[model samples]
Target chain A: MNKPLAAIAAFAGLVFLGSGAWMLAGHFRAQDAVLVEIVQDGKVLYTVDLASEEDRSIRIEGADSWNLVTVRGGEIFMEEAGCPDQTCVKMGVLRAENLPIVCLPNKLVIRFADSQEVS
Target chain B: MKLTTRRLTELALLTAAALIIFVIELRIPDLVPIPGVKLGLANIITVYAVFRYKPEETALIVLCRILLGSMFAGRPSAILYSAAGAALCLIGMLAVRRFIPPKWIWLCSVLGAIFHNTGQILAAMVLMKTAVIVSYIPVLLFTGCIAGAFTGLCAQMLVARIDRKPPA
Candidate 1:
């Protein structure tokens, strides 16, 4: 194999290994309270404690679209969206710290809040 | 960039082909729920163009594809993410092409994918004004590598088959 090709292969291998480990760490990380924040256009619209919050839905209106965030059974997921691609809705639930349910068109993000951010 | 008529026509044709691919791929169901995870099949044309044309010419094709693609998809907000990703991907591929032979085009494509994901994360960070999105980088990179290899292999095969000269 050529040197450049070998180098590229090595780089990709390292990236895969590193990223795989990172994601696994996120997955296996311990949890305290399941606090999630609903943010639109960088503003915190709502923060709900899934552990105690009742089953309810929040509607977020963006500049050009909308999203329905729902919490049920102590899980937060996108229930509906006005955007063409329902990627956020399909994400199912917010689990990993690294992976946030995102709706780009609506500029909405549903993610677990860092414990420090809680007050 | 001095564009001969033939070069201009080829660029236009490639742009159209990329737009069509972009629109068609939109019909495919989400392979994963993540926002940035995609096959990015339109990038096959991009990879082919990066190897076949000058950097500026390749850039033009990519720009045209993104602009027209978002319009057709009716998702104007997506244009920002796509444009940033394409720009970084193009620059990375173009720079790395010198080190990579045509036979190993997939390597360049993988690098491009990494750059593309980085650009997406950067755009998301700026737009969302939160570094929390940085956490998605690992997942995006993992997926980008796989998708990039597939599209790269497709481009490599096209490079092998197509003659550089236009048929008159």
Candidate 2:
């Protein structure tokens, strides 16, 4: 292998190995419970409890758009969205501590937050 | 600029082949829901193009296929992401073309894959208006390696076979 090729191969290998380790750690370790707040245009539109939320669904609407959020077994996700991409809906659910539910067009974010911050 | 009829025909056949693979891959259930975990079966045609066609021709073919493929799949929103990734991947592979021997085609493919992910992440950050999406970068990088390596190896085999056969 040439110098550049070797460098790229090494970089790719590091990325693969690093992510694998992160995922494995995520699997075995317990994640801290956090609160998720959905804000739209500077307003607190929705608040979800990551640890205690029940299997339920909620709808949030914007000027000309809407998204259906579903929480099942304490996990929150976007079941449907009016956006063209539907990326958030396709994302299914927010399980990984590192991965957050996001809708670009709507500027919506559903992520884990520290529970202690509220108290 | 006019392309020979034979070259155009070859391009058409390759385009069709790429689309077929793209559609077939869609039928396969998604193993991950992170919005980017894919085997990228269509990249086989890209790998073939890298070896057989000129860089400009290869780029044109990829652009047409991605646009038409997205429209056919009824996922117009995917155009941005696909186009971004394709452009980056194409450029990266084309640049590496001069250095890497035919045997190291997989290396070029891997580079292309990494750039593809980088482009997608950049687009995601802009669209979502947040750097939070960067967290997914590592996972995408990991998957890109596997998919790139797979497609690269396939392309290497294809090139070897075609090179063995004399011009028809």
Candidate 3:
């Protein structure tokens, strides 16, 4: 009912709306994300050009854990993991530029790492 | 802060209710694979307690729920993230309570949620020592607002309908 509080609420609401929209738009427009990187413990263990690299599975070992990352047909995803919560496996695939398939327990991540970003 | 029998009972009830919602939520299956994303339906109790009870009482209830929830769920690692989020959420709501009246409870809830997610992001950043995780904040912010609004309304309704001190 108060003006300042209402203004604060309106400002916050707009900020979230704008950020959500921008993130989503970027996600969709990132179809050119061809370079995929498999990062573990903040380190890139492998970088693959989905277009040129042959289909393969990379087994990432993490402090007494395992995550099987798969790359095929210009896409990468967590095929499976030894972690109790199969959150990464359920992520399906690494499609968006910002969104990444992550297995926290295993400390693994599969994300779109644009060619230049790949290390 | 005297621990009256009634206050003790209320705190216990609130903690139990939150834990139940948390456990049941675990069974609902992850709506998304992204870490730190959840409906957090249990937050309704925290939001309600923050408004209805003393600040310390609200903190106790939230602490008990976080500790016991993780213990029962057998995920000690989760305790870290949950604690961080709940602590920030509690602090944010309590501080903002002075400015926002009961009628604008939803705004307070949204603010609390934003703080909660920010806390989680900070925890993840510290633990992993990576900035890549920051990208998840926007998504969390978006979902946090919607979920916060729903739980906030639920709390507001309960507060309006139930008297803190029932006729003895």
Candidate 4:
């Protein structure tokens, strides 16, 4: 009811609504995009066409950690990680455009490329 | 700032308590796959200390906790991200403290969480050197708000209870 409380509430509301909308848009827009990139330490290690790539696994080694990136049946997922948290492995699959599969400890990122970037 | 023996002891105790909470929270399975998302239960102490102690004192406790916590977790690599998030969160909460009375400490906590998320994302971008990392901003912000509110509300209840008790 107080002014500051009201302001805080309004600010949180805006963030919640805006983020929710952005995430939704990102998810919907992610469909039909097949190009996925595997990046580590800011460098692109591999850029594969998921829709056309063969079912194979790529082992990416970082400075102190490693990740097993697998593409199966046209879907990409982190099969394993040397890091303890295993967050990237649990990310299941690279689904949303805005949500990349990340392993902070290993400094690895697996994300879908922008559709425009597709050749 | 003159830190009397009693003040020093109090800060040390708060830091230890926060470190314990941080370690315990690590045991909890990741609620989501995102790198920066968590309950951040240790921040409850930070929120309580922000309102109860001087800004410099609160900063000391947080810094100590982050250093010790990284060692305990055996994830030295994560120290950078944790430090970035904690520093931004502390500064933001300290500045916002003036507007929020004890009753609304949760609001300050929420704002602090936002700052913490921003710091983590920025650190990730710089360290990863990838513009694609920007895509994570929305999800991290969304989760940060929830985690921040939870920790803030816990700290608010803690403050209420501690204030009700007469100083011994």
Which regions of candidate 4 fall more than 4 Å away from where they truly are?
Answer: A1-5, A116-119, B164-168
> How would you encode candidate 4's per-residue C-alpha lDDT over A1-119 as one tens digit per residue?
67866887788778877988887787777377789988888888899898789999999888888889999999999999897777788889888777889888888888887653666
Interface RMSD of each: 1.5, 3.1, 1.7, 1.5
Model 3 clashing-pair count: 0
How many pairs collide in each candidate, listed in order? 0, 1, 0, 0
TM-score for the A chain of candidate 4 = 0.90
Better of 1 and 2 by lDDT: 1
Q: Write the per-residue lDDT of candidate 3 for residues B1-168, one digit (tens) a residue.
A: 789897799799999999999999888998766788888889999988877888999999999999999888766777788899889999989987877877788788888899999999888777665677878878888888888888899888887887675222
Cand. 3 Cα-lDDT = 0.81
Off by over 4 Å in 1: A116-119, B165-168
Question: TM-score for all predictions?
Answer: 0.94, 0.85, 0.91, 0.93
lDDT of 2 at B52: 82
- The model with the greater TM-score, 2 or 4, is 4
Put down candidate 2 lDDT per residue, B19-47, tens digits, no spaces: 99998887877766567668888998898
Model 2 reproduces what portion of true contacts? 0.46
lDDT of all predictions, in order shown?
Answer: 0.87, 0.77, 0.81, 0.86
In candidate 4, the residue pairs with backbone N, CA or C atoms under 3 Å apart (3 or more residues apart, or in different chains) clash, namely none
Scanning candidate 4 chain A in windows of ten residues, the lowest lDDT window is A110-119
What fraction of the reference interface contacts is present in each model, in order?
Answer: 0.70, 0.46, 0.45, 0.68
Native contacts recovered by model 1:
0.70
